[model samples]
Target: MEHPILFISIILEKLGLPVPHGFVGNGLLEQLCAPYMTYTWLVMVFLFVVSKMTLGNLEMVPGGGQNFWEILIGGLDDFFVENMGREMADALFPMLTTFALYIAVGNLIGLIPGFMSPTSNLNTTLALTIIVWVTHHVIGFRAHGFNYYKHFIGPMWWLIPLMLPIELISNVARLLSLSIRLFGNIMAKETLLGILFMLAGAFFAPLPIMMLGVLVSLVQAMVFVLLAVVYCAQAQEHAH
Candidate 1:
């Protein structure tokens, strides 16, 4: 539990706050989201309330805090709409926004001294990828009915026998790619920063690299959201 990111966990562990069997006394690795999960949940709730306050308002003009959230939502809306089209973007807005908020927050939290990004864990990223993967296909089915599999069956009927397994494998590979990409990037940044802090100096030498880690964190979050938008756009092609 002594890895640099688990500063909060060390305190909780010391207080005997109950570890789940195997997590007991693991120095290098602890549960992925035990202490951080509660913080992540609270952050989500805060964002939800902010969304309601801004979006649910009848006011034609936004106030200060409302304006901040509006800009974020509006900018992200435009980003997705540019890629996915207005109709599909509008339809998938809630899911896209939720993904952006959670992943962005999760990634950025890793920059905090005592906190770990859940996105750094393969299981968490895989769960999210699976959700988006299943969701888009479900939307595809709803939009295209049985015709949805047409995307997988290849553009030519004669190619089904040759293309089917290839298509299926590629589809499944998306799960791995999405999860591994997020986990690998975040974990690399986290581990690199820890090493820099240790080897560089006892103090200020790691600051510049840590600042770059902030940029890396935000970019990773954006890349995840952007990919999700692309997948949704591809799936809901019927609406166009």
Candidate 2:
């Protein structure tokens, strides 16, 4: 079935940039004109505007926006410290927080009418997984220098022949795991909600599913972040 063309795609089409109506298409044109790309850009711009508005006026006495942000930041900081130790968390706080917020928002946005979740796209999820994969490896390298490579090598030299390929495959599996998990969950949620809306019409019929979607969105985002932290923590550990 042809995927529904988003409002953003229509806008782009009106501007002489016609986007393909299907989820899969060919080449650079497909990548550039994908509806998910438009939604991803929308998510970015929404985040930027909201962040600017929230952080623009920083008062000594916190109001609603300031207080909410402070609580969120503080909570995330403590969570990271508990999971990955203080030093590592301090180094990773900003990036991890960005990932959490972006994923959470991207997932939830699809619950709104006339919008879609970028996280539902394999490209978006795979890009995020790659970032996390690179980040943890970089952290490992920085923490242990050349010794980071030792983690992939078996403890006993003889076992290297067997363990090396296994370790390489295991690491590669993380990329697939992270990307597919998020993409599958979000896409499933979107599909379910769409089906429910279609079968039951726009009334209160989809309310229950919408509520569940909200919970699923938050849980998936938390799971993604938690796994990322664990991966980074494991990376920094001394090879036994």
Candidate 3:
């Protein structure tokens, strides 16, 4: 039997609906999965559409889409400011917001039947974690210059040997933890949803499971964003 989401996409295509699609090929699949391309395409299209819609016309009275974007962006800005302070938040807002949105969208894309969340893939999560790791250090360096390394050093001169390696290991662990946390949660959600759907078939039994998957995706995205903010905040932290 055909998958429900694939079947729906097929029906929509037959009806001439313009659902975003990728050119399926093993060459593309060898390096990058179809969902990764789909997610990337969606993000590009989202940016283009938003730019065209809001551009210079953003005014006292905003359109629905602009208003929604404002609410999302504004809320995130406020949250980051509260955690990281105004100056740091201002510097990182664009990157943070972009990552959050991309991840949220990537997670949700899996619910569309044929598409799986690119975040479920370890490669995608590792790449995201590395970006966050680098950005956090950049913020740290700008905030404290060479003294940023001082943060990794122990409180005392003698402890530098002990503390530096420990700190280095801990930092390396963040890369693993961030990537694993994201990849594991997303993969688990998809696995559970697939199993539930297979067992329950078209019945309402799997409906709740589907909703659970959506909740998992959202919570995981928020967790990932919150952790990123915390990491950035730590990197910029001064005064011990």
Best by lDDT: 2
Candidate 1, RMSD to the unseen true structure: 4.0
Better of 1 and 3 by TM-score: 1
- Weakest lDDT window of 10 consecutive positions for candidate 2: 1-10
Q: How do the residues 123-204 of candidate 2 rate in per-residue lDDT, one tens digit apiece? A: 8999999999999999899989998989998798999999899999999999999999999999999998877777775577
Model 1 / residue 124 / CA error / Å: 1.3
Judge candidate 3 at residue 28 and give its lDDT: 38
Q: What are the lDDT figures for the candidates, one per model?
A: 0.77, 0.90, 0.79
lDDT of 3 by residue, 1-240 (tens): 224354434554676645445423256342333445545666557667866877547777888877887888889999999999998888888888888888888888777666667788787899999999998899889889988889888799898999999999999999999999999988887777777777785786667767887888888889889999999999878836
Evaluate residue 21 in candidate 1 and report its C-alpha lDDT on the 0 to 100 scale.
Answer: 36
Error of 3 at 10 (Å): 9.5
Alpha-carbon RMSD of each model: 4.0, 2.0, 4.7
After best superposition, candidate 2 residue 92: deviation in angstroms?
1.4
Estimated TM-score per prediction? 0.83, 0.92, 0.81
Give the Å shift of residue 69 in candidate 3: 1.6
- Model 2 global lDDT (CA atoms, 0 to 1): 0.90
Specify the highest-TM-score model's number.
2
For model 1, how does the per-residue alpha-carbon lDDT over 1-240 read when each residue is reduced to its tens digit?
225646656666687764333322344334532654545665678677867776676466768877887688889989988998888888889887888888888888877776777677676788889998998898889879988887887778898998889988988898889889988998898777777777764777668877888888888788988988888778878532
